[model samples]
Each structure stands twice: as structure tokens, then as C-alpha cells.
Target: MQLLFAAPARKPLQVDRHLRRQIVRYLTTCFEILSPAAEELIPDELEQWGQLRIGNGGDEIHARGYHKLRPDGRDAAFVRYELMVDQEADNPSVDERLEPESQYGELQHIFVLTIPPKTPKVNPHRKKKRHLLLAQIYEAPFKFDEADKYKVIWYKGKLGTGEVVDALTIQCVIDAGEYLYPYIPMFDSIL
Candidate 1:
């Protein structure tokens, strides 16, 4: 005789409003400051705030803004803002670095804000998502060799068949700027 068992239903993840608002505010402010010249060209109909489904099969709060326009009156480049909230307490440390894999394809700009786990919990058997949040904002062309900047990691490899592999990893760890401080009060309250 064969026995049948029913699988348990999964519950939807809860949305944290405070964290979401912080992420939106940060992204909006950055867009306004970074690309002031192209701001007027962006279409007003685009989504200012909404939920974006990331590659990891999870929905994150996102704010989208256009920054550039093409000669034909079309949007050329836009910025995407993402917020990743870590609920698992036993997760690893929060890395301020941004990886290429974390970004969507060919976006002109991508900003991710990660909220660390509120409390430490034990969960050794489960796997966690790999995501990094913004820790600092730096002006372009800034020298990495500066005293405050962190060192970048370079990885090179070759396949047995003589194929070469090239990769570069950069980690950012600077103090969050004044614009980001407003969100801190909300983050502290939630924790």
C-alpha cells in the first residue's frame, strides 16, 4: 500500500513600511543630485514607487526614475532603486559592496539598500540570499588608493582547455552620508 501526504502551503513575506520608505527616499535624492542635467527630460508617467520582482524570485520595494533621453524622444537610461530586508537573524554580516550580479541587465544606475537582520537567530541548515547594500556614496573618478577606500579584489582563472577567465570584485565601506541619515531613525525604530 502507498501513502499520500499533503505539502504545506507557504506564507507570503510581510512588507516593512519603514525600511521601504527609507530606500525610496535615498534613491530619489541620489537621482536628483547625480544627474541634474537629464532630470527634466524624464517622462512624468513612469512609476515613482512600486514593488519590483528581483532575479531571486522575491519582491522588493523599488523606485524608478529616468535620467536620460535619446535623440528620438525616448528614455535612454534610468535608475532603479531596490531595498532588500533580511529577516533571518542568523545571516552573515552586511557587506557594503555592490556586485554586478545583484543588478538587473543594463540599467544605467542601480541602488540597493539592505537592512540587516534585527536579531540573531540560529539556522545553520538553511541557505540565504547573497545581497549587498549601499554603505557610502562616492563621486566618480575617485581614486581607490585613497586612505579611506577599501582594497578591491581581482580574480583571474583559466579553464583546463586553455580558456581564460577574468573577474574583478570591489567592496565599498565608507560612512553613510548626511542624505542617508534620515532613514536611520526609521531603521532604529524597527529594530
Candidate 2:
């Protein structure tokens, strides 16, 4: 006899315009300051990968960049950048939106930074875990709890290949009134 099992339901991944720009700006600025040399390499690298475009924004800035193979052996390659904006009306109540789950109106433009695992060299004691890029903000009028920081929310999205992925260390959220404007602390670092 054949047995039947229940399949779990999946949550939807929302893409916002303002959030996309914020992510691109944040990552671009970060890379510019972190590695100016790398910034100059973006154009060339991007060409070899594929075309990029904003997927869900009115300003043709929703999506940016394409995936490419890094020098390492990982599932995916390269970073996909975009900003996510939780509009004023979307913000959930302090009680509900505290955690990444129920929180609404949390605009989060995510830079899907993907780095594949690299092969070891002479030492042979190096093995890196696959990393996916993700960052976001949870903005609410009233402060719910101290545990959940406004910045950094657990986000999940699907890749171009339709493979499900999860991104950690996703810390980057906009303030209540600051729509589309990211708090670029490292802005001055850009030359």
C-alpha cells in the first residue's frame, strides 16, 4: 500500500522597490570603501555574468547584477543587489512586527551575496560554508521589545534557478520616517 504525507506550506517572498535601491546603494558603498579596487572590477565582472535589471520597482532599479561563478566551488556565485522598502502603511503593530516573522512594512533591500566554497591549498585545513546575502529593517512606531533590533531580520528568497535559499547576518533596516533612505554609516568611506 502507498503511504501519504503532508507537504509543508511555503511563505511568499515580497520584493519592494525602495528596498532594492537601498540594498544596492548600501552594498555598492560598502564595497567602494571596503575594496575600492573591487569596485572598479564590477563592470567587467558584471558583463561576463549576465544582464541585470530591477525586478519589482517602477524606476528600473528593482534588480541589479547577475550571478556568476566565483573562483571557488560553491552552489551559486556572485551577489544580487536590491533594496526592500516597508512603506509607512505597511508597518505592523509593535506587538506583532517585533520578530522577523509577523513584522510587516519592513522594507528590506537585500544584497544576495553568494560565495561558494573554496578548495584548500597547501595547508588543506580550509573549508568554508556557503553564504547567501540578506539584510533588512523592521520599522514600527512603538518599541515592542529590546531583543529584536530594528536592523537585521531573517529573510528568505528564491534564486534565479528556483532553488530555495536562506541568508543570515541580514542586519540593515530603515527607520520609521526614513523611506528609501538607508542609514549609510559607511557613506563617507566611499572615495
Candidate 3:
């Protein structure tokens, strides 16, 4: 009867130049911040792992699947989050060390990595357990309007990918009822 169980589903790991750069940046930034876990990971090891489980947890600890990233403080994943991407601020005009500052990017996926407790005991430390998060993300480069500082211009496109972000990310931002946008490429005025 055990054979009846389905094999864990996995998508092909397609890391293009942009994604690769992002991964490298993520790793480098993590290391600079003194993250011990980040220190262990090298780019060469990504191919070593067969799969990176998404959507649901693979272990008993994080088996409760799918938390809606809402503003209600229910889930760790936020819809429109300013993801801390960079470790340093861009030329801070104030008294600050020439160091990394919290920078934000667009959030793509939230991986809640379940780490078993040391010494084989149930870990009592559950203070914001979901905060143990790894996020797949992207950032749009922005330029303030020359004449009108109030207006901002930024780059946002698939950059060749079929979809810019997961549909769930969009769904979370929408109202309680149904809402719809044009298919693929639409709207003459916007673009």
C-alpha cells in the first residue's frame, strides 16, 4: 500500500543569468551579514541538491501547508513586501558605517525551512517560527522623475520569463471578491 503514495513533485531547476546573479547576490549578502547557514552554501552546491521543495514542507515540523500572506499578521509572507535585499544603504547622507543596510526587493516565493532541534528534543522556542524564511525574489530598478520628484519610474517586466511572478502573489493583493486584468499583454496607454 505504501507504493500508492505519489512521488514528490518537482519542477526543473531553471536558473538563468538573472536568476543566477540573484542567487549569487543573495548568498554574498547573507555571508556579509554573518549568517552561519549562508556561510556553508556555495554556488557549486546548488546543483548537488536534487530538488528545492516549494509550496509545502517536506518534514513533520512544517507539514501544515500554505499560509496566506496577508496584512492580518496570519502568515510570514506579505503580499507587497519590501524584501530586504541589500545589506548596505546607497551612500547614506547621515552618520553611518560604510556597511550593509536593509534593502527591499519583490518577493517571489517563501520557503519555510524546517530545522530539527538539536539534542533530539522538541524545540520549545517557537517565537515567530514562521520567521525562519528564505525568499525567492526580484527587484525593480527605479529612477525618480527629473522634473517632478513625486513621480517615479521603474522597470517591471517578465525579462523573458513567461510570468513575472506567481499567480498567488497577485491573488493576495486583490480584494476579497473576484478581479481581473487583461491577458498577457494589453492596454495601449500603460505600455
Candidate 4:
């Protein structure tokens, strides 16, 4: 029952993404992906998390983390979406300097959609499925310590029940943190 857009329109922006094992390698266990909206329901808990303390630098606070931000915070360096799963995964095993703190838990992996440099006509084939694209990546020693659950929001598109076909949510939670490594166009053309 996830809404795709906030307004109705004849032409809607669509997205899709498929990652191979390489993408998984970049993200280790511990962290899980979650939808921006679903994360909202648990706000009170998040606020309390801020009181938690972390790091050798005494008195520093730790709070619940969030994937997305509000319009004002839209300028945020990266946009995040949920990657839900049934069970806990292992902690990310990438280079330590490249990872967020274990307290954040390894909850990496977000999907985004981009228009590229040019807006080509939407292909009929590409429209068949709900898609997500990887627009950017984030590294560790992150800007924030814990996720401010209240900060992020979910996708609020207007699909109505009929126009919409399918919706699914996977919730992954890790004790470590997640990682995101953008997919590079390994080749100039898929020749």
C-alpha cells in the first residue's frame, strides 16, 4: 500500500534497479534497509535513542537513524530508501575507515531514481516494473551519529488502488551499519 507520488499526473516518473552480488559485497551484515514511510511509525522510540551515548569522546549522544529527509533537509547529501528483510544479517566487512559506526548497525542499501543528463522518452519496457536506481553513495564517519527517525519520510505518490499493481516492503536491521556502492556503467555500451 505504498504511495508512489504525491500528485496525479499523465506522465509519472518511474524507476527500477537490479544489483548483482558485487553490490552485496559492498554492504555487510548488521544493517537493514527500510522504507522512509515505514520508519516514520516508530518516531517516539527514535527520539529516545538520542539520549544514548557513544564514542570515546564522552557525553556524545546517539539517536535512532533515518534514511530520508524532509523538503528543507532535501539538500542532504544523499537520499535513502528501505531494504527490508526477515532476519538479521552479518556486520559489513568492508574496509573499517569506509564504514559507519557499529552502533548505527549495518543497514546500508538504498535505491533512488535519476533523470540522467537528458530525459529520454520513457520506454514501454522499462515501465513494466516498479524500479529504483542508485544515484549516489555515502561513506563512513557519517555526518550524523544516530538516525533521527523523525527526519526521514516515505514516498507519497498517488497511485490509487486500481492503478497500482504491487507493493512489498522488506525490513532489514543490523547491529553494525550499512554501505552503499553505486553501480558503475562498467562499459560504454552493452555491446
Ranking by TM-score: 3, 2, 4, 1
Task: Give lDDT per model, in order.
Answer: 0.24, 0.27, 0.30, 0.23
lDDT of 3 by residue, 49-87 (tens): 111222333211111122234445332221222233333
Model 4's number of clashes is 39
Q: Over the stretch 90-141, how does candidate 2's per-residue lDDT look in tens digits?
A: 6566333222333222322323343334412211234664333343433322
TM-score of 2: 0.22
Error of 1 at 78 (Å): 8.9
Which model is ahead, 2 or 4, in terms of TM-score? Answer: 2
Report how far residue 2 has shifted in candidate 4, in Å: 9.3
> Can you give the TM-score per candidate against the true fold?
0.16, 0.22, 0.32, 0.18
Cα lDDT for residue 92, candidate 1: 56
Model 1 quality (TM-score): 0.16
Sorting all predicted structures by lDDT, with the top scorer first, yields 3, 2, 1, 4
Candidate 2, run of 10 with poorest lDDT: 182-191
Count backbone overlaps in model 2: 22
**Candidate 3 residue runs with Cα over 4 Å from true position:** 1-8, 33-78, 84-93, 97-133, 139-191
Write model 4 residue lDDT over 1-191, tens digit each, in one string: 22222222223222212222222222223223233322221122111111211123322111122233333432222212233333323445533334221111111232332222222231224435323322112222222322654322121222111111011221112112122433111110101
